[model samples]
Target chain A: MSVLDKIYEKAKANPQKVAFPEAENEKMMQAAYETGKEGYIKPILVGDSTRIKELIAERGYEESVFEIIDIAEESYKNDVVARYVALPHTMLKEKAIGRRMENPLYYAMAMQAVGDADVTFAGIDNTTGDVLLAGQMIIGLKEGISTVSSIGLCDIPGFEGSEGQLLAVGDSAVCTNPTPEQLADIAISACDTVKGLLDWEPRCAMVCYSTLGSGQGELIDKVKEALAIANEKRPDLDIDGEFQLDAAIVPAVAAKKVNRESKVAGKANVLIWPDLNVGNTAVKLIQQFGHADAYGPMLQGFNSIVCDCSRGAPVSEIKGNVVISAVRAMGQK
Target chain B: MERKELEAQIIKMVAQCYNADEAKLSVDSVFGEDISGTSVMMVGLVSEIENELDAMIQLSDAAACKTIGDLVDKVEEEL
Candidate 1:
């Protein structure tokens, strides 16, 4: 079965409560309807009630299936939201100040903060900054967390030699060019996420254009430093880098080229790029040109649960994203 | 700073980072051409601009920075 199938089964068994904040959007409302029908999650649709009803009728789905929180009317939304925040005065005041907190994205986050929902996903109509800030400010980054990054969970279907590979390419959506320390944190966080969400033992490769001392540059040095730090802290992990992409993934290629007897060599399922550009571009390339399936650009390192999807994503993509985000919310890794 | 001065600074930074001639930079300088900061360099430039200007410039902002003048206007607006 596919990864989504497994997750959907797991989620269905537990039937965790999840939220779709931008439920007012036509596509999101449609997705919520499907999610409800599937019985994997109890979805809270946060937006204007009338708009949601219109969308439900528009999609030809039953409106009684999902719960809706109407934020169109200030007094009503404020009354409901105010009860949740400890600083009710401040939240109430803010509700009165702005145009219903811009959209349900913020209000939805506030809901998650107060345990109204187990996981929240948005960004179809929001920017990364908007999603990140709402998450950081309202949800807040976790203690000991510095920045948020993304991981792509690619489920390649039965490539003759390799059956299942769950790889992570990161610092893609968040940090620009992380400091060496930040890179170490990213590696550790990604390793944990991979182990938790995908159940794959991490064979981490810190990738670059160069392979194992073949190249000389500052970028190479950064990758080397990060690998060293990550290994020192989590010595049990098979993490090594300053290697090229090909050597990292293919065991025979890595054995011949990298000259390292390390287990991670040629067996890397988690690839941590030197920077955001490499990580972001590499994943997109894999998805676009290589025909490899991709999931996420899911945010990591937040205190409470907050995740973002692409503004251009379809409902299935968002559904896949929710699986990853919900796994994160469960505090697995 | 006058908009032109900021423009000049942007041109200088792009020229240095992208290894292109300063003369190629203009208000409409698209990054990938006439000098380009690979993704790494773009992030670095964003940091530099933020540090120099004490503003919080985002990567999304960098996506629109095509030319020397384009970066200058962005920097000026943020400043």
Candidate 2:
């Protein structure tokens, strides 16, 4: 089965509560309704209750099918603010708490923080910065993870390297120019995510213009440092790199280009790009030119499950993201 | 660590983050305006400080620190 299908099966076995902070968006509402109706997740929509009811009525979905959290409700607002304040070492001061309490994204994260919700999928009408800030401020990062990065699940059909078609390309949406340390974190997080989502051991390639010592530049230096750092930190991970794209994936090319014997040199399924420019461009190229099915820019490294949707995502994609988030939530539980 | 020692470390780390010499930075140097640090760079700096000091420096708290001195104070507070 496909990743989404496997995720759906797992989600069905363990239904998690997912909050949609952008309930005002029609796409988000539709996806929440569909996913809720299909029993993939228990949808909690954060918005105005009356308006959400109207939208649900218009969409021919029963209002009883999904639970709606009205942000304006005094009790709910107080609950979210209380949760935010309770978070240890929260830098959201008293003055900012009121303003943040007014935001649904914060409310969604607050719900996750306090265990009112299992996961949150947002970013329909918000920028990545806003989503990430809310996540950082409220849900916080997993222990030992200082940076939050993103991973894109690209399923390039007929791709030779991966056992399945799906490959995890990371730091594509967040971390525009990650330092070596941040790049290592991104790779480690992506590997953990693959292990969680795909239930397979991840072989990661730190993708760059150089393969081993074949090329030289500051960029290659950064990749080499990231590879070393990741290897040192996560000795169990099968990761190697400073590889050109061909050397990282194609075994024949890796054999010819890389002098050292390596496990992940050519057969890498997780490609950690050196920078966002390369990672983002490669994912889009795969989506358009390579005709791949791409699903994410999924935010990783948070203590709780939080995924960011592309603002332009359609209803189906939103529903798929909800499933992905549910699957992540299940894994965490 | 003593105040002077901590301040010296903060300045050195900030200068390293900015890819400049420690001589170029001071306790009064503002992080973004004076030292050319981006938000991403600040995150890295926070992680570096946490690792170096073996403390939890909250990102929000780190972001609130405008200058090298402020960062030192934050680190000291965490310590």
Best by DockQ: 2
| TM-score (C-alpha) between model 1 and the true structure | 0.71
* Estimated TM-score for each candidate: 0.71, 0.81
Query: All candidates' lDDT scores?
Result: 0.70, 0.82
lDDT for each residue of candidate 1 in A129-232, tens digit (9 for 90 to 100): 77876665456554544566667776554432222544567866678888776787688778777776666777888888788898989998998898888888
Number of colliding residue pairs in each model: 9, 0
DockQ for each candidate? 0.04, 0.07
The residue pairs found clashing in candidate 1 are A142-A303, B26-B69, B27-B69, B29-B66, B29-B67, B29-B68, B30-B66, B30-B67, B31-B66
* Alpha-carbon runs more than 4 Å astray in model 1: A72-102, A157-166, A232-237, A257-261, A331-333, B1-79
The CAPRI category of model 2 is incorrect
Range of the 10 consecutive residues with the lowest summed lDDT in candidate 2 chain A: A89-98
Q: Per-residue lDDT tens digits of candidate 2, residues A46-158?
A: 97888988888887888887889998888767766777667775545444555565778877888888899999888889887778877876677776565789888888888
> Given candidate 2, what's the lDDT at residue A227?
87
